[model samples]
Target: MRRDTRNRLLEAAEGEFTAHGYPRTTVTRIAASAGVSVQTLYLAWGSKRELLRGYLESALAGDAASPEDAITRFTGLSPRERLVELADLVGEIAERAATGWRLYRDASAVDPDIAADWDELQLLRHRLIARVFEDIPATALADGLTPKAAVDTAWTIASPDSHDLLVRRLGYAPGEFRDWMARTLTAAVLAPDSGADTTM
Candidate 1:
């Protein structure tokens, strides 16, 4: 019951934040939408900032699961198979993030509170990705680019937005997209190794 209430509040808050953005959403509105009292919201999240933070954190969760899971999920996947899985994952994650991204992207100007939390979230996300890259075999084999550059490039290639734009929008099947991305990103991580395009 406690968890259910919390989830309801979060759902309401997410809808409110997405609809009105962080600057405009009020606690009373949020509570009402959740079918709870303002006091219940306060008890659950303490403040508008906390609620926003919680919403943002939840949105980011899909993208922040352990790196190993991501790798394992793609393990049996040929680069193409992984790419398809990644595309589906991208679609799934983006659907969840749609509203939060809007609020975070647009609310930075009107709300200092939103801006602060948004900035922190971006930093936290990047750090988690940086941590993941620290263990990548590709990073070691990659040449020409600095280690940081290679890691950043690899991560960017694997990002949801890139997948959406490249695979989903471009009309390539998810598998083809994932395979191409893996090969391209692999090249970016390691040296060309000569005649590699022929291998494809």
Candidate 2:
């Protein structure tokens, strides 16, 4: 029952935040939307900022397999295959987390509390992206591209901002965005002689 109530509050918070944005959204409104009392909401999340952070965390944790496990599965795949798999994983994450990220990004502009949360989220994402890149064989990397550079490339390409521009603003279908990511990563990260098929 507690879990269900928490989920409802989170759902309500997402709707409220999306419609009104962080600055305008209220705990009262979210509680009303969730059919709970404001006290209940506070008991669950402590503050509106925490409620928003909870919503972001829930959205990013989609129903699919955890990203860490998914990355581990990349083992033994060829370089191109790994890139393609990574692209698909990134697409899934972007689709699930984009709205929440947009909310956080916008809120962080004016809210110091949210800015700290946003910075922490960025650091976590960077660590995950670095872990993903760590699985790529060094020999497969483009000449003169250090592991750090490759991770940076992947991180930039897979960022929520990039996803918003391509998938949300530019109207690229999710699959199209994924395919583009695969092609771009292949070209940018793989050595020409790495034998990883570069055909788009």
On TM-score, the leading prediction is 2
Candidate 2: where are CA atoms >4 Å away?
64-67, 197-200
Candidate 2 local lDDT, 160-188, one digit each (tens): 88889998899999999999999998899
Report the lDDT of model 2 for residue 120. 89
Worst 10 residues of 1 by lDDT: 191-200
Per-model TM-score, in order, reads: 0.67, 0.92
Model 1 scores a C-alpha lDDT of 0.64
- For residues 68-97, what per-residue lDDT tens digits would candidate 1 score against the true structure? 455455444433333345445545555667
How many clashes (backbone atoms < 3 Å, residues ≥3 apart in a chain or on different chains) does model 1 have?
Answer: 6
